[model samples]
Target chain A: MNGDDLFSGELENVMRWLSTAGIVFALISAGLIAFFLTRRPGWRMTPPAKWLLLVGFFLLPSTTMLLGNVVGFHRVKTSCAECHVMDPWISDLRDPKSTTLAAKHYQNRWINENPCYTCHTGYGLAGNLEAKWSGLRHVWHYYVAGVPEEIKMKRPLPVKTCLHCHAQAASYLKIEQHVDPEMEPQILSGELSCFECHASPHPRKNR
Target chain B: MSDPSPPEAKPAPAEPRRSILALTIACVLALVGLAVTVLHLAWPSPLMFTLFMVVGQGSFAAAMAVYLAVILVDLRRRKVL
Candidate 1:
């Protein structure tokens, strides 16, 4: 179970480091810049000050922000819930009595950490990149174009999203329909979407 | 074209007022970004995350652009480029 808690503790440590060292470094750089501003110009600026401005102020903080966003922020459930549109789905995912596939996984801890991201994001590097790209597009929609009333996937759900795990599982392999030559190609080609058989993963109301 | 006006030697390099201001602004932008990013990391939210993604990263970009312009101008003026 300790290994399962990887998302729980390691993220806290990252947060603590960023809030402490990260904030302090930026503040210190700001103070130094202010101090340098008061001094007479010309050749008064020492090389050290320039290096501090370049590295301490700019380089470190930018890298830290990128790291913070990708590593830890994406793992938390509320990170997605932060957008009001996702509230209904997050609530359903948490509801003990909810019969949704997502809720069952959540209650059972089948995916452990970041069940939302895990299910939504497909497997592998391309999938990860696509997820991040979609994330950016979501922000653009939320702010510039306005969010749609009923959220819908722009494309057919990738069967790989479900198959990456399920394909090897005994429950899935044992099913005659899954291994049937007739059904297998349809599933693989995504002509037959996984959820078509499994039904709704989340309720209709995203809220 | 033969009027003999003296070519005065370059005056003492004046203080880099513009570059200093640029760096100052850069500092402010970066600080605000760092703060918002930290806040979001502490408590997750779409609002804060959006700010972090937009304002926070936006400030960094603005700051970097200013820094770049300042550096280029300074280098050109000094004939170092």
Candidate 2:
């Protein structure tokens, strides 16, 4: 399907998930209230009950967000270590491997701290920025708003951000050996990000 | 020991206070969502359209309805005929 079709389908799925989650949240909130009421003898719900229920409401979303943060942190750490460099960030990345080639994204400067979402847009279990913003609007999302309403805002790295430090010393023995056309029209026109084609940047057999 | 007024001691029922506040917030959000939706329908700017549609104005309506339902349930439980 076309991009528009794909985006629409994805949005429908997202709304369905939100509906399910909202129902679950409401159910759990009610269950906790029931449990709390049962626990207290002759509990006519003193002022403390209000505070307790409010705290639980606050904690519900906060705990979910904290868990999400942990998972995101873990993913970035692991992904960065797959083919990271021998440097400060890479050294501290989740898992380090000296054996892998230098072409990995872990070695890339942009992905160093940013991780997968840095390029891969959209929210899911991982969270994604909606297509409501893209193109000039995306630039505005970063530059104008300064703060994205839907998702966390990340400052755009320097021009040629991904390639600036990535196209550096190749860990491979033969540096010239590569795949895909070294140059593309899209790149010259600044129409595409490096991740569009060279997502992982791993060299294949043919260019 | 001091005698306490029924209003002070009873505290106007927690259910009504909580439900009213939740319902009011839900209503206000629903109205804002609706306003955004109307504006998008008229002007159709990308930004405004995004604000209204993808954010799901309908979702806000649904939330308000749920809050109203909760208030009804609480009212019934409290036996306010």
Candidate 3:
């Protein structure tokens, strides 16, 4: 199936319902735990009850996370739009005629589904964890501290993300500029930024 | 004169062992869950992701349930229910 089809009506609806149910379950479980803890009964919880509570507590977050991921996948555009700051970038991506690197990539489907996530997420285990943590921080900033007017990446994008696709590709390797033996060290060491030559994928003007 | 006091009962020997065993199982399960989650995040295929979501989270949930059960049983034994 096409990537877009994954977010189509029926699946999206199912994911939304599941997300809502998971949230309700989590809240109820939390409330029960709170009640159990705060109640003025001298009586201790039985072993079975204690185990149930423990399981319930673990399940609350775990289930919620699973559902959250699924739901987030469906609402990627909407969730990103919540900050309003990403409006220009999203619009550019959706624009077929746009010439920006990111726009070209999106329009051509160079990356797999979820173009934003594909580019933004780092490589490997640590990179993935970092991405998830970064996402959480973004949510925290959006909800609690309020996103800054000029949103910027916390750090420079890693060259590895680019290399993950381009390094071995015949088209990329065929380019003379990419094959400069002298430049290889600089590229690997990150002394030279990829964007310097290629230009910013998402141009500042679009923002 | 004060009446003779009753002797304190000895705790059951089996209880601690059971709790320890349950704790060990929980720890193992939690580690497995964590590993699966990390793997899923790294590779990110649909099947792997689904497996991670189910098995990883399920393991944690099961571990917690086991611990809670142990606590409940202990409470019952103490007549604190």
Candidate 4:
């Protein structure tokens, strides 16, 4: 999507506000920790109280980080949908008239909820981490740097993601298009793109 | 110097060495876990991130297990369980 289409005015404002708030909160937390650490002898806290405060100081940021991860993991789709840029894509998935491969997979619940993440994220542990990392980077760019004019995938969508589900599907394997041994090898090796045949994978408008 | 008074009749080692060892291991595991988690946050690569998550969380679990073992030993020693 074009930069403008990638992020709407409302989304931009919300992101700016969130980022500013995050910075403010971080500063406040650091200041409090510093204040506690630099207290004078006469105003010294009791040993237990001092230890408790020190532990809290150390735990605060880590706790915040963990909370963010947990929230992102569970609410990925909602978080992604917050950016209106994805709205059209999500809507297209739900559009009954749309016959794109993506739309069919999404509408049919073949991949379940968060269909965007399901197809986009790599498979297994490494894939999950990569997706999370990419997501964090996306947030950083959207909030810290101005959103780019063109939003592009970091890499071509991996064939592995497609094969993860379809490889084992009896119906998929039985299909004539997938029956050719040469075609299977080529597709598996990434020599061929799935979209080559599925030309209207996400047709912008229904035909 | 007067003969070292028969080594001062070394006092019996009352504190449970096993408990102390377990607690020390727990603390070490916890610190390593924290370090891994911080690394994951700072410079995340896919492999490192996966390793950190597995090892980091595993360390925390191991620490808890060690602590639990200590508790169980203490309870048994005290005849409370």
Identify the leading candidate in terms of lDDT. 1
Q: Give the least accurate 10-residue stretch of model 2 chain A, judged by summed lDDT.
A: A198-207
Q: State in Å the error of residue A77, model 4.
A: 4.0
* DockQ measured for candidate 4: 0.04
Q: Write the per-residue lDDT of candidate 4 for residues A111-191, one digit (tens) a residue.
A: 766777787788789988888778766665655676665565766777777888888899888887786877988888888
* Backbone clash numbers for all candidates listed: 2, 5, 12, 0
Task: Show model 4 residue runs off by greater than 4 Å.
Answer: A1-39, A42-50, A59-64, A147-150, A204-207, B1-81
TM-score ranking, best first = 1, 3, 4, 2
Model 1 per-residue lDDT tens digits across residues B1-81: 886988867735443766776777776777777777677666655556667777887877787788788779778877799
What TM-score does prediction 3 earn?
A: 0.57
lDDT of 4 at A12: 40
Error of 4 at A64 (Å): 4.9
Give the lowest summed-lDDT range of ten residues in model 3 chain B: B41-50
**TM-score attained by model 2:** 0.29
lDDT of 4 by residue, B1-81 (tens): 699657645523443655655655665665565556555544434333444556766775686577567668767765699
Candidates 1 and 4 compared: the better one by DockQ is: 1
What DockQ does every candidate get?
0.32, 0.05, 0.07, 0.04
Report candidate 2's interface RMSD in Å: 12.6
For residue A20, give model 2's deviation from the true position in Å. Answer: 27
Question: Predicted chain A of model 1: TM-score relative to the true chain A?
Answer: 0.77
Candidate 2 lDDT tens digits, A1-207: 566664475644444344344334434544554554454433423456545445333344233223322332333322323321223334433234432232344554435554543543443433233422342254345446663333423543222444334445364223333223554434434455554543333322222
